[model samples]
Target: MPGMVGRVPTSAAAVPGARSAHGTASAILGHPWGGTALGPPDSWDPAVRAVVDLVLSSPVPMALAYGDQLVLLYNDGYAELIGDRHPAAIGRPAAEVFVDVWHLPGVGDVLERTYRQGESVLEKEAVLPVDRRDGHAAEQATFTRGHSPVRDSAGRVVGVLTVAAQTTQVTNHLESLSDFAAALAGTLTLDDVARVALRYALDAFDADRVAFAVDDPGGWRTVRRVRGELLDEADERLPPLWRRVSGDSTAPLAVTARSGVPIFTPDGQPMREHAVDRHDQKVRALASVPLRSAVVRGGLAVGYHQAHPWSAAERALLSASAELVGQATERARRFETQHGTAQLLQRSMLPEHLPDLPRLRIAARYDPGVDGNAAGGDFYDAFLLPTGGLGVVLGDVAGHDVQAAARMGQVRAALRALALADPRPDAVLTGLDRLVASLGAEAGTHELFVTVVFGVIDADRRSITLASAGHPAPLLRRSAPGQPRAEYLDLPTGAPLGLGCRPRTATMAFAPGDTLLLFSDGVVERRQQSLSVGLARLADVVAEATSGDPRALCAVATAAVAGATEDDVAVLAVEYAVRPSRSAAMEMPAEPTAPSRVRHWMTEQLTEWQVPETIVGAAVLCTSELTTNALLHAGTAARVEIDLSAERLLVSVSDSGTRGTVTRAQTDTLSSRGRGLGLIEQLSDAWGTDPTVRGSTVWFEILLPAG
Candidate 1:
């Protein structure tokens, strides 16, 4: 009876002058608290009374559960949340009153931690099922709840206080905005931006249709997506087509893009007045936000098929999304412009084509770094020396910029000039070192240095003399019977070019069917790996190559690495092989008598080479047919080259035409245009056509009679 509130004498109250309570507070004061763990109101501890007073005085939804049984007490603000269970719920156990959702993760766990461990918990967007009080089923409510422990005079936690705020709509909007930002961050081009923006807008805005448009040089580029389709039919290109829109266009997207204004219309009348097509006419409402950027102007528009009133929150989200897209578009445009110019400058400094020397098959390749937006300093060159030997060089400057490209051009020109003046490998490198030092002195920066490997190939000696100036060792791949061998050349390594030092040259036997590979550090450098490991990998990959051809070797070396390189890569490969024992070339004009002239020229040359008369006749006939075809189909000047090896005769006719490789299927016996190819294929021992960078080459090989 002492714990019961109704049995407490009116004259024996704790707070004698305290004002009369109201609402849930009044209910708490008059309820029967007999069997509850909290006992009666008059017999309750001062700590419990203080916490109850605090919960009832707050304006926000708050509740307090006290003692071991966890009796529930709340204010008028919290009573609305419990529906019809409030008056009878007062002074009752929380687990009994809210049995449906008390065991949920954030609900009961948060209260238990605060009560038993004296820990505070803040739970966001928690779902709780509460009675509807309208005779309908219970509805789930979302709330952000905070739980704090209540302490007594002895510094021990006695109860748990809970304060909650409904945040369903706010949480949804924040999540949507965050997702939109994340999606836009990965876009790298205008097409990417448009695709991501249109797709996200359709789902986030819940609109029937979404359109993203940007101002282009000629007109406007737009991409649209409907709710159920991937993209509009007319805009299916990877980068959608650009449609010209005049300044006076009445389309909502165009107007906002041009004027940098946002337009929102809830009624269909305004949309009808400015409708540009059938799609616009079907839109009942629209919201257009302008993309605010210093470099490019654009706009985004969301359309609804049914009437929809745009809320302030929705409008703000649209504006923010547009801003993100605008910034990304600007960045992509800048990168494209810079990358194009950098590539052009880097390529213009390199050799257009390698020298075509006898007994020396040469091939070179250049690839930019992963960041293609900047110019790199890697370079390669090959030319015929005055001494009749081949001069080849591969080098890298210390930076990636316009200045580095200019320096690369300077070093390349100087090396060629020095090699021509004095064809010695060491002398060429020494001269280059002086030039590099002078360049660094002029630029007033010691950072201007270069690594280069200069080599001279002497065909008669069957040897290549190489000198290095702080560059990676050149690789030598030997072609054996069943096992090929690859090893790095061991030469005296000198200081880099800027710091002058005497370079020593080493000559190695470059026998027939052997290849020499010169590459930059980019070809053998990787993240988190030692340089020796990369070098070993390169050697292994090169040794396993199927052929010793220079072209195939270059391709295999670059592809040996698995991913994009951090630095530019340059590779130059030279293969020593059995070339023509005797050769001659003649150029004929694209005239009616060109084939006659070529036939007579070929007959005289083959006769001088002491080719058998029968062989000469067949060779002259095939040469005539190839020359005729080149003039008729190519309509350009043709080059006739004839090479006589120890056991075969090679004839090739090249023309500077755009016609690709001529296949056997194209050589119909009935057509006058292809009769020559058919005849050559039948008469020659072996014949084929190859597509060159500029045009095509049709050649045939005839085996000589045995001695």
Candidate 2:
């Protein structure tokens, strides 16, 4: 009656009627539609009556719209499917009843074609607007719908019947699961796994909050995202958004993680007493699933701010997602273990620290390939020679594996031994060449080869002698008055180390305020780029650099060339400063009086060097704090070294203990044990820590007043 748009009879009693219908058809007959389009069901044509009986008898969701008005009629199943549109929609037109979505291509067009052309149509995964009945906005529903043309007794098309089966939940879950697996496949570390899994879970599960945790030896490492924002923690020892929960805690996440059991709370009121945060108190539903794996144990928790009925399908999806996360966590754990071991082995093969010499500032950097799980063969070293000159070498073996790392270690050890014995660049290379040849012969492989550049710097003569074994030429940056230039040395190249070939030495003037850069091929080798082009690019970048500081130059060069290198990179830079640094060292015992003794010795040394009293006092106080920290926390004997230059005074305290780098204690300001770092931060211009092979070094620099 609401959508009657065609000519209608004045009264149902005036027409010759068909047999009486029943059920929904009986209701249509009882309606006050005598003056409406269809008049009454008892007065309808026989064909329309028969189709109505067929549609009403079926249990599947089915509906029909008849005649030119396309007036709607549906069974009880379809009545429930349309949500609140129920009986009111029964006699209305399809377009008026489904006003929000009747014009969608998959709905009105398909029905129109079926009614007009008498064609039957089937659409898979058709999208329709649906009311969720949860006081929220309407959501999209997916269904597989079939439409058939209803014909009259005269063989003319009369109406269209549509049968729909909802598939929204299944389709959405399957797609989300597939994408989750693909995302997890690229994760390689615990942090990466946590990030990917948590974000995906929050989106896929439609939860207000999500958390991920992994069991570690120290405690449980946890990350949480609440309402699209990752929670921040104040602990500087852990990574960002990561908190360490005690393993024995009674928290839901911890309980599930330890017992490998899932905990589901549909009504979270009972658990509100144990809430840890305001969000937790407001949670109306939650699901915590254990990440069960042979290599790692963890948990994932999802929370909702409104009440939710834990449906069976939802539970099954949650379990499946947990399984995927567990597998990814295990894989990441194994990769991290292997990567850590490989990196440790590789670093152990290189020098622990560069030689801290006067008049020469040296710095080196090494990075593994993109796949860091495999070891690389790049190595570098700098040591004091017996002839009072400095020997620096950077080399690369031909392969990337354990054997390559071993050979690199052997070659590096032998080169240092050879250089200390002769101190001549050419002699060192010739000896290294023979050793490599013997190694190759023993391994029964002609592929074992190395490319290296060795240089000897004589500070007294202001000169450097260089020799090469099929390595890239070294770049020299000369900083003269109003004239700064950078160029590569044209040294004669020989065959790589495993081949028996003679090497020639080239001499060049290494003036003060000039820097020399030595590097492996990875630094200058890019895909689809020529070596000469890369070298020229490096020269231009070096010329544009403002300072001659070896550390700054190394940083710039590595940042410029190694941003996306597939191979390992190694860079070494040495700068001859304008004025040579004067340095001294003393070893102190790990006793209570170490700090006092360090203070007195430092004051005496600075006084002997004619350092200003204010600068000397500051240096002594900062050095004392660093030395105290080393002894208190490291519990090992410490080595104190001081380097005095025209612009700054640098002091370092080294110990052979395994304690990690120290940070200023945020909560323990009053405690004497942790105050040393805070004092160092306030008193020094720059201060930091470096992890060494066996221990660590804590150093600070104080800038001097203008001369």
Candidate 3:
């Protein structure tokens, strides 16, 4: 109507004026303004009574707003809709009490416009989103809101009245009708599908709790409870939800299972709605919905809270989630089972072939301690490089599980590939360092830094080049006759792979009869002393095991360790030939001779003794200078004597040249131009002048393997 309206017609009866006896429930209950009690129920008009009945009977929560305040309310269900803090909102400002709805675009403005202009406004499907106490998001609900102005007897607008009914439940129903068909696409595991469905149901449909239960021939069992209170305690209470007595059923699952469809229980009740709580209070609100799998016979129960009724939108959400969870759960379960088998397959791919090098007569023993409960990660491998160089590597992967072992295999393969490509000890390590830094260790683990000791042996040359990444040094045995003892070639502790790319290398020359043993720290680190002492002990044992064969030597050395080391141990050994007599002799040619003749003569002596090519060149050059000095200072007639000994080469040149007597000076000076003697002093093992009555004999010795 163009003018202010007094009453609106509907299936409901007409409402009375503001000052009349027909006031809202709050006003009738002695509210300060516009309060009046209706006549007894029997005395009231059937029409007005019917309207009252209709408002009370409706499941949707409702309230009446007169001007700025809530003046009427119906049952407890309607009062609780406003939440605990504001339940007794009657006579309070409608905007203040239900602030969430008052702030909606068309709600507050429409009410204000109706009061000012004496107009009436109608709104359909208004929605309010609210955050619940549990921090979950909830839709306050969809509602049909209307505002109408009330006029006095003189036809003057006095106040505006408002009507609202929450419609969230109805909306959910329609939405779910279409959503259910698309919820479970491509999901193959029951648990996966169930979790997805439960989440969507609780979030979209406003279900209090959700759960998944499987049929086990005889009964049902709850496999998972996505959301629900009392889940741990009330397990096995619901029959239809699960086929076997496995675990608890969530509120939503129990409700749906018993009702054979989604059930709404606004009051927290373990049984039917008609059941009353006579013993106690504090019952929470609850709802339960069932999800049936199209591909499987299992079902999931989705739950909701009791404090609020199910909104229409919420129903739609539950339907959609039901389908998705059913399918997803089945797929996840199957995939998880298959993963175990995959781990076994990976274990087989580890290195199965190890090289057996001679001179070294290498032996590799792999002990993956305590099988079954865990996967093995320790690894060792050796092979002959294309360069006739032998490569040996020993490493420990970061973990002791199957996944760790699998990853270890991959790392080992990469290392082997590098070994095959580079064949050089340094190159292989450089490649490994680069690879791990870039690729990274396995997931669910921190950065990996492996302790590896790698070596390259040139058997023909009797030499070895090795590199270490925080690994212990290899043991060496002096197989050269007198004392068969173990010695260690110490390598610096370079940072492990991916640790600042530090370079490391150490070289050792082995004689034919010497045995070189390379080992992990686990062998000796178990001693009472520190690592240094342990190394000494290893050297001590190797020295003692000189009489044994390669296998016997290994056994005896390993036994020398008092007890087992906590970590694994790896050892490799090589023996070389000894040249004892070659190092015994000495020779010196006469000086003052032509330089060519001196050189020629020095060369003859070195060739005669068959000194190693490395020291031969230097020895020949030094001999010529010493010989020429004796000839120039003491005259051409110099007596030369050569002493060939097992431990060194000693040579002397005696000349009758006298400059008083030349003493080996404590300090070097210009007058002491015997710089040639200084060269002899610096290069030879020992050099001195033996004073004689006529002249002095200057002699020096070059130490051989005796050192």
Candidate 4:
């Protein structure tokens, strides 16, 4: 519906500094509310009448006005422009045509300026396109023309003349050009892009609303919608077709693609009526604009408060915006794909194999950072000791990223070497410290250090010796037939390696029948909860899990804690038992006569035991070499033990003689002798003699899986 009109200057064309020459005429129109005139005007001026006649007779369809009134004019096209004007319109002011035009800044100014300047002057154009009666995106273009004056017959400018023509096509084309620019500028996210494109389409046709539908497996689905206040929240719940529409259009992206052209359906019929039975607030007239471009194959629908036809300009604008939307959607998809790849790669970097140790049912697990945002530096490892003890280690690097994880791997490898070389908890730490410090100075200035807990399980001693380098203490669970409880050990309390000169170390000895738990700080640190609280909770859960596997216990503990932790975690558990040595339980002889004899004997024994050929060879070579020394030096039949613990093989040789010197037999032409002890020293883990009541026990441990 047209709004009432008011007179005003054409501010856009006004000179830098100038007043209207026909100020009085403008004043008359401007003061309509002052109660000066009682009713409609009686007649029109001759000049105004001529302009009115031409507008009425032209096929373009037009409106005429003079001095703020719709002047009675020629008859032909005027009827359609005004809809249904009576004979009385001839004498009435043009203000009657509109409901509230006078209040609009630009429209009112143009009217006032023309009325004040009597010498006829052409007004700048105001174009609009109207669709046919049906709701569609196509259009009927219209152009409004006005005339002003420099002076009147009495040398005083007063009143103005105006004529309007419907030129929908050209106007719609220009509007489409502007929509292209707006679509590019107004969108950010995919959803936002869709809405902007839809809104542009509706604005092009001067429709009430715009809706976007995506094709789905089921059908067309309305995914996004935009509209005027009349249907404020109506589109929130879209029709099934609209929601699924995105999938139906094969070239939705192309149609929606920036360079893609949209398929036009000026008629609203293609769009199913949505919520037809719903309340008035939920229903509105609709128009559909189908897109089949390479980028956007989905269809877009424009809704109107009433059934309004589309104008050519409006259709053009809507199509241009659709193309803009298509490109945005493609960009969004690419971003999502890239992000998904990053997450997968990060997740695959963690270790896949876990170490198993004897006397200790060692099980290890790792969990990467949430959503795999970045690589985390949490790690856990277990290996067999020469003495059949389990070597367990857990640590966390300082940062979160692929670089930090790489550094963590380097440190882990260094520590693994140290574990095999020294076997002593404290010695391993010392070696790792040295390696970290000497890892090369040119690798960037950023310092790298790690908090670690390294410990060995002495299944024979029924205890564990653990050393810590500023790491969280391992959890200890002590249990009997019925008695059960868990306690946290105090960490060595020292600085992390690579930062201090002399790294401090503390070693702990696990009690008989106890379970040792090792973990990264992430396991016991939760946001909003103190570290101590988490530790206590973990202890409680482990105690409760006395009857379940330690791994299960860890899971329960993890679940018990809140899910807000931001760190990666790793855990290792080793349970101790008083059961006979793996060798003794398996009924292996405790003594071997000599290296040569032992080698020959093991070949047959291991073959029967189902050991792989390669492994049997390595085991025989290692055992024979160690046994030869005991026989030659100790002067006794050496007791041999081969226990297959989860991870390590514990070997011990005992003799009645006790001595510090382990000399290689003198050889020369009679060689093959001295090499026996040399082989033992080279192959076995840290070898030493421990005095027992029987004599001195010379023993060493080796890993079952040598690598």
Top lDDT hit: 2
Q: In candidate 2, how many clashes are counted?
A: 0
Note the residue pairs that clash in candidate 1. none
User: Model 2 over residues 522-630: C-alpha lDDT tens digits?
Assistant: 8888888887877887888887775666655665677665346778888899989889888899998766677888899999999999999988888887787777667
For candidate 3, the per-residue lDDT at 309 reads 64
C-alpha lDDT score of every prediction, in listed order: 0.76, 0.77, 0.52, 0.52
lDDT (Cα, 0-100) at 28 in candidate 1: 70
Using Cα atoms with residue i matched to residue i, what is each candidate's TM-score against the true structure?
0.55, 0.69, 0.34, 0.39
Off by over 4 Å in 4: 1-350, 356-360, 440-446, 480-483, 501-515, 545-547, 575-707
Cα error of candidate 3 at position 116, Å: 5.1
Deviation in angstroms for 120 in model 4? 34
Candidate 2 TM-score versus the reference? 0.69
Off by over 4 Å in 1: 1-106, 109-124, 127-212, 222-255, 262-288, 301-315, 356-363, 367-370, 444-447, 458-463, 477-485, 509-515, 543-566, 574-707
What is candidate 1's TM-score against the reference?
A: 0.55
RMSD of each: 16.9, 10.5, 32.7, 24.9
How do these models rank on TM-score, best leading?
A: 2, 1, 4, 3
Q: Distance from true position, residue 294, model 4, in Å? A: 12
Better model by TM-score, 1 or 2?
2
List model 4 lDDT by residue over 101-146, tens digit each.
4445545566655655444545345533332324455333355564
